[model samples]
Structure formats: structure tokens, C-alpha cells
Target: MGTTTMLVQCNCFDDVDVHANSVIGWQQTYDQLGAGHAHTTLKHLTAERFQIFRETFDKRIVQIGAAPAGRLCLAMPVCSSEPSVFQGKPLTGESVTVLHGGQEFFVQSPGGIDLLCVAVDIASLETFASREFSSADLCQLSRITRLDLEPAMIHRMRKHLERLIDNALVGEALSEAELEEQVLEFMLVLLDSALEWSVGRSANSTVSTYLVKQSQELALANQDEPPSVLDLCKHLNVSRSTLQRSFLSVTGLRPVEYLRALRLNIARRRLRSTETEQLTVARVASDLGFSHLGHFSGAYRTLFGETPSQTPRAR
Candidate 1:
């Protein structure tokens, strides 16, 4: 007799750091790019050898991380305010990012990005591929960083994965072994679709990913003394206009807006921390380069809808 014991979990998180840690068997860090309350939802179904999950976020988020070592992971956007960028390529319904075990990846979503992801053990995936594909096909699959599926194929895959989770949640009489077999078959079908269907080209990113990443790092590192747009342009060796356009394209925020948000978020974190004794709004604001306490409080309230003094109390 076949039996299945799949675990289903639905969780809501208010903090990006805590949300990143909620995923099983992955190392991920989520940075909130837009201000205001951050709310996220993750619904996952985990079986013996594979997992599928849907992630939804309310704020603009930049997710950086690696999947579990020894698993082949696939992720695609289901819905978003705008197409999310995956390693500098726009991720859409017809586009999927493929990562082998331990491959590092990054994705930036403007806001309200809904993504469905799947990860399966390498051995199980190899077994499935071996049966349905030639050796060359397997080799090519291993080399694929991204796969552009036919539109219908992407839709089918999404619906199939959703149905599997829905079935398991409804206490359908599907055995664990049976579910595993079905999931492996689904992966095989996806591979076959990739091979047989006419692949479409995904939209290219509007800005250079390196420029955005380096700019973000520089901004965060200088939170105590936020750099001006001129400084960023000079450091990047790009014209001010180019720098402005790049930040706007990638982050949906102008350079100044994004940098200010980063500093304010850091200050909010510090203010909310119970670990720091005698912490004050003035101290937090000053440490983050806020020279005027009144201005800092006003900006903080505008962004997060609460006064700086209330942050620690609420936390």
C-alpha cells in the first residue's frame, strides 16, 4: 500500500529577516526596498523528496540567496506589480530561473510579487531526466541558468503544481509515494516542454544589474553618512543622469529616495531593538545621519506611519 505524509504550512511574516528564515533548506536574505509595513505570505507543501511553495510580498523586496545544496530549484513569477528581475533578466509567467545545487541567485521585485517555486533532490531529478531525455539533453539541462517555456506550458505547470498542493491539503487519498511519482513526472513534463516547445525570449532588464547591486551596497554601507547622488555617480564612474535612470529602473525609486529609505530602515531596526539600552529616537536618528531630530521623526512617520518614539514601544 502506498502512503504519503506531506507537510503543508502557511505562514505570515512582518519582518523581512524573519521571513527569509522561514523557508526550509535554503539560505535567503530579503531586503525591503520600499517603506511602510512589510507583510509576506508563504504557503508550502513538502513531501519526502520535493517541495513546492508560493511566496507573496507586500513591499518591494530584493531577495538574495541559494537553494538547498544538492537540489535542483526552479522559480517563476506568477504575478507582480511589474516583472521581477532574476539575475538581470525579467522573470514572468513564461520565464523561469533554474539553479542547480548551491547556485547563488538574486531577484528584485517592485512590489506585490507572487512567485511559485519548486525544488527536488538531484538524484531524483537525474533519475527522472535519464528516463525521459538523452545524455546530451541532461547535459544541456544542467547548463541552463534560465528556461523560457511556452506560455501554455508555463500556465499548465503552474496549475499542475497548484493542484497538487490543493489536493494534498484537501486530504486527498494520494499516497506519499504516489505524490512523489507525480511530482517527478511533472518535472519530466516540464523538461519535455522545454525541449519540444518553441521557447520565447524573456524581456531584458532595463538597467545593468551590476550597477544597481554596487550602488545598493554603497548606500547601505554609508547609512551613517548617506552618500549623495553625485557621490554615487562619481564612485560608479557614471553620469548623474545615468545613475538616476539606473536606480529608477531597477528599484522603482530614484537614487535619493532609495538611499533615504535604506537609512531610515536601519534606524527603525535600531529603535525597535530591545537589546540596546537607553536607546532614544534622537540617538537612532543621529546615528543614521539624521542631523535634525524633528525632520527625522517626520520622515519616519511618513514612511512607516508611526513616530520614531512609538517604534520601540510597539516592538
Candidate 2:
């Protein structure tokens, strides 16, 4: 299947009894199951973003007042005492990971547990934000800025999320360039606020936060030549197994898988979406780490169910 990417959504797991876990890639989010993360005991009264994100990026219509719903918040990956596998086998720990969608949340359950989640599609978000800020700031914004929020922060968050809703409903209210700024600023505001709320949810919560930040930094640091599992641990100060477990719990992709998948996803999207001008499939694949076009094409076809071609428009 194509990498299942839900740009902006708020759906729950099937049965509504399962835990909120990792997001599938931007192309095939719903087709594949979310990455398996630790479970939580918190009860979510609502999980709007999960459902909304899936449809948002696909040119779907926005329902009225969804922005002002007061629940269209960011999400963080929260794990409970559930069985989760990373790399291969099972290990024990109530670990969480930095989810691209938003802050991790958990609430104590008196009887039944509720898990509410919200995450924005990174691209849709950048599309929206360019209206208000620069692309560079948007990069900073995507990092899930950690902070503590007071009542003031909460109010700010509500306002920003609402603006996104308004803009989403009316496409290009601003120029495309402007949309990037707006989306990045919005992401920055939400992530900063989420950190405030996460202060005491679990001890060493920041460990997960730091790991996520550093992990991504390292992952991209050498995109020309990414590191091995052992290399990542040596550089990041985590065990290979610990890092492996951490990555699996959140991304549903192993370290190598994460890098490869990222490369393939980028190549695929460019091949399909950016045909406004002629593009070289080979160039894109190489930029994303494909040394062998034949091998890469085979993998791309399997992942996207279509061959990379100079074909005009998708059906």
C-alpha cells in the first residue's frame, strides 16, 4: 500500500478500545495500522484530530466550527502497560514517543479509559502556515517546542487552532508562500502549549522528548549518509535496544526502515504530485538515497501500487 498519511485527522483505533499509537506515513496512514506504542490508562473524552487528519489533506471539506470545538488540540504519543514489539520481540516499559501529530496526553480513568488524540498533517500544516511565517520558522515550529502553559497559553492555543480551521475551509485565503508561515507558527504555538500540559504526566517525560528531538536531528544530520543502529546509540547516548524500542513504539518503523521509508515516500510524492514541471524520477530517488533505480522502482511500485513514470495525472 502507499504510505498511509492522514494529513489532519481525529479518528480512533478500531473498537475504540485500543491505544492511540504512531501515525502511518503521509501517503498510506489508514491502510496500515498505526505504529504500536505503549498503552495508557487515560480516558479521552474525544479524539478528534485522529479522524480529521485523514480527510483534511485530501481536499476534503471542513465542517463548520471544528476549529472552535476546543478539542482540536495537538497530540503526543502515550504508551500504557501494553505489549509492544520493536525490531522483533517484546520488551517491557510504559514508554512514549514524540508523535509528529502533537503532544502526548493521558488522564486517569475511574472505570473506563479514554484516549483523545489530534495531529496535523505536516505538509497540510506547512501549506497553512506559509501564510503567516517563513519556511525556516516552520521548520523550527515542527519540532514540538516544549514549554509550560498557563491559562494564557491555553487561550493562545485555542485561537491559533481556530485560525487554522478558518484557513483550511477557505483555501489560499493567503498566498501559498504565506500559508507556510501561518502553519509553522500555528504548530509552534500548539507544541509549546502541549509541553506545558505534559509537565507531570510521567517522570522523565522529557527523556522521550529529548530523544525525539535528537533522534530526528541525527536522522537528518547525515541524510547523505545516515547512521547505523550502533552509530545512533553512540552519538545519542542510548542503548541500541533502547533506541530501537523507542523508534518502533512511536514510528512503527525500525531505524533503517524509517530512513528508507522516508526516502521512498519523498520520491513517490514528488513523482506523483509535483508534475507541474517535468521531474526526473531518477534524480528524486537518488536524492532520497536510492542507488539502484531498478531496485528502487520495484520498492516504489510495491509501496505505492504504481510505477514511477512520466505519466500525466493520477486517476
Task: Give the alpha carbon lDDT tens digit for every residue of 171-232 in model 2.
Answer: 41333323333344445445434433333323144565576557777766766555555456
RMSD of each: 22.4, 19.7
Candidate 1: tens digits of C-alpha lDDT, residues 36-104: 999898888886588888889989999999878888888988788899899889898887888888998
Candidate 2 whole-model C-alpha lDDT, 0 to 1: 0.42
In order of listing, the candidates' clash counts read 2, 54
Candidate 1 global Cα RMSD: 22.4
TM-scores for all candidates: the values are: 0.59, 0.31
> Which stretches of candidate 1 lie above 4 Å from their native place?
1-5, 197-315
Candidate 2 regions off by >4 Å?
Answer: 1-206, 310-315
- What is the overall TM-score of model 2 with all chains considered together? 0.31
